[model samples]
Target: MTLTQRQARMLADMTTPTPTQHAIQVRGLTKSFKDVEVLRGVDLDVPPGSIYALLGSNGAGKTTTIRILATLLRPDGGTAVVNGHDVTTQAHDVRASISLTGQFAAVDEILTGRENLTLVARLRHLPNPGAIADDMLARFSLTDAGNRRAGTYSGGMRRRLDIAMSLVGNPPIVFLDEPTTGLDPQARLEVWAAVRELAARGTTVLLTTQHLDEAEQLADRIAILHEGRILVDGTLAELKQLLPAATVEYVEKQPTLEDVFLTLVGAPTGAPTPTPAKETR
Candidate 1:
């Protein structure tokens, strides 16, 4: 078939790969607080529609990394790109394409669940804020408690609402920084379900978790950070392979006291569980 110049141009455009396609791309990310160098050099690639967990102990630069990616804090060195926009140079554009749900719920205790979402929609200047609020309330199962003040909500409920509010603009990438830190076992499970749902629905989630089990349970890939550097990054099975071969040792199969306690309490160390009056995911 003989094609005109316009047809050839259209075909080329259709086949071209987007230059800014990754959900997140960070190279040699570094940060310094006064004289202390927290993140010496770090690099990461988070693909679209996946859950990537950053695991680290306290002061391991997990929060710093999230802050830089979310455009909340500027990096002293390196580069971070979110949804094809440089976080430093295109801070506004990057922020417009992402949401950051911090360690604590950023809900307004004074407003009801519906009101909170409505306020966010209005702030973003979306069309029909009331409709969006109600729709979000329903989507997160907060319809029943939509009228109740946020202060009356449980820990899990607050966290759900907090996350739901972040989705008001429906950005493709979400940043969760130690989201379940202070929640009870059941509450943690609920949040885990929510995180799973987010990734399943094609939202790229970059979460920082202190608990090893949490990373194993929810992350499609995990990165272990120490002293501002990634010690390892891979799937759980891949990481396990990196460990030395198991040594032969005699051991009982009986559950330990902690195991029994956990089983009886119905809360597995991390990930998520528990029912709230209103669930949000």
Candidate 2:
């Protein structure tokens, strides 16, 4: 069947990543605090319009790496670039092209959800801060509660609003450090969908997470960081290949405790969880 020009263009856009452009590129990136070393030497390459997850345990320098990439912390050694702007020399330019969502939601407690986003918009000098705030509220399913103070918002709503505020400047790269922490499973899925929508719209996401399933769900590529260094980097399949082959081939399926728990809780088996269908404004 022949497709029309519009359909062809849509397909091309969906399938093709922005070539010759990398949202984040790092080489021998190093950082240290006091007498202790945090990041010995780190390297990463995140292409434009893809989700690259950094998986690590605590004190693995994941946050340190993200901070450096977002231009929040200067590295002790090496170089990194975000949106082609050097994190070392062009820190301001790199900051301009990126947004950072840290482990905790950064919202003003006394301000309404709308106000919180509005404040961010104003700070960024975005045109029509009120309109942008309302748009973010609607996009995150918070229009009904936008008038209420952020302190009154649920954890999920606050998290959503935090992410919405990060998008006020329409940055090309976003750094999400444990975005789903402390959320109910459903809320986690919502944020996951939002992250996907960002990538689909040509935004590059660099996420740090401890949740293995999350990495499987949202990341196109993943790197495991340990002791401030990347232990492995590859697609999920490639990582699996590196693991020892399973000797026991199960001809019959057996439900495990996790399956039973999920069944009891009504969790879907790797299905796409429903998310806010509102168009991003």
Candidate 3:
């Protein structure tokens, strides 16, 4: 094609709307820490407004991938685009388009839950920080405990608050790095609800978790990362199809240990019980 014709076609292609666009895209992503390589040619595409779980065992480089996409760490090789901005070149734009919630809750123990939310709001220079905090508290079902010190929050409640804080600016994408780690089964369930709410509200969530069930329950699509490469990527049903079909067998269904534990403790479904009032970080 002539150069002029090629330019016109390119412009037309750019103007045309795609049925769907990836919220996060990684191509041949590679990262190395000193002598030991961490990520080796990882590729992922997370659809907008869906939960994409990156499942892997320990040392699988999940966190490394997240850090690269979040612009917190530079990848040694390859390209990662988050929210349509290249992480390496358009780092500022990428940062503006996403939030990162690490494994642990980053709450200020001394601050009340309300205070913590407002603190993040103010840091982001959002308008009416108090109102924003209140709305977030209500949205995350933390309104009842809004005035309580974060130190007194149960593990699940704290995680909810932490995630709420991340949504202060309404960034289009969020990276949750093992958000349920170290939480009790009840607490994990609590966080799971929050995650569901995020996807429901049109937020793209890229969740990294080692827990197999977490991926099964939360992800619209799952990608298994091992030794820095994605082994398989698909919906739960699609992934399950990789193995041979199960034989026809009838067995009595048994209650899972987690089910019995939650039932025994009388865990509330609406919310997790808070830590004791006397408990402090």
Candidate 4:
């Protein structure tokens, strides 16, 4: 489908039952550390059950914004509402409504995958922690390795287990901060599939990442952050329109100078370098 069509579909989806309400709402959010201002009057509105992508270059305050929304760090200014609960005024309610998966897997190395999930279930006060653990183990396809210590699992397996643990309470909103950083292409796809499944099941997702293609693939709406401010916020096509129209180049002869440069330096010339894939949902 065309980018315009994709955006139209997203806007239409926002009014549906999937995202029944606004999962996250922010206004004039600003934060500073010492003398440096990291966020400058940031604002965002994420519909429930939709994947919202927060894209930015390094040092652009993407992580800082996610931290504030997740209630991990307090913002210096502005107010945020998650699931109708204000972050500052109703922190407990906000916490109860959201789950966060940070850049690194937070699972315990010594604990088996099942043990880790059981721990989260217990923390969430689930009625049957054992049952919840068993369900997640099968849902994430970790049943075979469920008894193995997390430290022994492959990187992808560990990441999946970490995310499964986060769902113990089944919070309506989830914040994923670079969730697929070091995995191979196949593993990355698996993570993406899992994220999509969650959204399909009516989970709202806020994702922060540097990977433009990932944003294009998953984000119903995309926000670009630059210098601690949102440079653009809209559907993928809207953001792409901020640049030139799509281009197609055909070379009939030999590899071009740009290709030679990329071959020698192992980096693209002039073209935007591909961002390292980091799992954050």
Candidate 5:
């Protein structure tokens, strides 16, 4: 079947109230800004309860694609369906079902963490907002700092609070745009753990990040975007197979020539190294 047809079918299926199924579908999605095309007929599918990572370099349209899916931006062509609702046609419904955390944490600095969660819960019309706020605080390990002003929180702490606020409504679909960009290693791991817990509990996630390792570690499937187009889309194993074979090397010499070459050329360790010369007589 064509990608458009598949997306339509996926949308129809999601509306049926079935327990487990696809949570997002996109096909032939095209977007342009002032004659500069950002999304060139992109197609994607995200299964329910899975983490789907959109991996790309800077200016590759990853953020543009994500904004469209989040219903914050509209595509010039094609369609997208999220959680049984069309992003363009049923924009309000789509917004109601999803939460987004952009590259920067969006939180009210003057408000306390607990207050932020309560505000979001109330906005979502959840009953017993205070109770829901408490639950979110506990889930994100922010209970101890919940009473502190967001402005006083550390970067990692603020990020956790932002994510916790997003979960106030118990959204079934979440979009995290470089959610760990500024986090330290420990904080990044904490965020990853939270993401895993969400997926395990049946929440579908769509994340965009330049961190390939993060995508490799957490994503069930990944799509590489290059120059506003999807260069490849598949599981990590499938994508790895598409690339040239990689090799690992070990040497007895300290501060080897390969390491020096990499330092000067600024290439990753996985890239092939040139042969080194042996001592001459």
Candidate 6:
């Protein structure tokens, strides 16, 4: 899609949603594009103000499910209620309650970061466009680069700005369709921090990612989607309990490449891993 089209769609998500007890509820949701069935029977229950990850491989209907909930596309069968409104019958109400960030950042190359934000605020007919833009820029740690054109931003910075733009109106729930796709490790970490902050502020996040580590890092609850079906849904520990306990064994653990890279680059590390390289060398 062209840049204008993408911006228009993002602006359309700025409507305010009514209060609801549950963030999202779906049952037997199905969709098909011509002969191919994308979603067979999907059931989900997302609690308020939590991060829910939909883990699936490519062509696993993650995006299709998100689109249906966001009211961008119609489902062929079953029901989806987002923020207390049925996705089909109450499409406008559903749209009012959520925002979406697609696989790629949909920012205008020519516009400055601040301009891009203020534009969305103005489109939504908000009260203070400048203040809203400034607040988002600061919230996403883009205050220093707010005046710079978005084309010059790094991958991580662009994604942060994209997410900030999606939050201008404070929609109750956000749909992130592979928000970290194509980002470098550092960039991905930056986006992860931003997502965590969103959940901390009582906003519900429905994240779709193929990266297992990403899901483990961000999601409070995870649902594995495969072949248009939900194989399992639970917390990480609950899912791990499904497997038999490991037999006792003594084995040396090694620092993974990620650890070495993060340490060498001075990026943040969640946990410390042994650095045998220093002693061996």
Q: What TM-score would each prediction reach against the true structure?
A: 0.83, 0.82, 0.88, 0.81, 0.80, 0.88
Candidate 4 local lDDT, residue 38: 97
Candidate 2 lDDT over residue span 1-281, tens digit each? 56667655544443333456677878888888998799988878788899999999889999999988887889999989889889889888988898999999999989999889889998998899999999888877789999999998878778888999998878989999999999977567668877887888888999999999999999998889999887667677766655456786435445555455445566533335333224332
Pairs of residues clashing in candidate 6 = none
lDDT (0 to 1) per candidate: 0.85, 0.82, 0.88, 0.82, 0.82, 0.88
TM-score of 2: 0.82
For model 4, how does the per-residue alpha-carbon lDDT over 1-281 read when each residue is reduced to its tens digit?
34466655654453233434578888899999999999998878898889999998889999999899878899899999999999988889989899999898899999999999999888877799989999999888899999999999877788889889888888899899988888755456567877887898899999999998789888998888888987667887665554546776553455555445445555412233434434442
Candidate 4 positional error at 200, Å: 0.9
Off by over 4 Å in 4: 1-20, 247-281
Off by over 4 Å in 5: 1-21, 244-281
Candidate 2 vs candidate 3: which has greater TM-score?
3
* After superposition, candidate 6 runs with Cα above 4 Å error: 1-20, 268-281
On lDDT, the stronger of 2 and 3 is: 3
How much lDDT does candidate 4 score?
0.82
Considering TM-score, which of the candidate structures 1 and 2 is the better prediction for this target?
Answer: 1
For candidate 6, give the lDDT.
0.88
- Ten residues in sequence with the least summed lDDT for candidate 3: 272-281
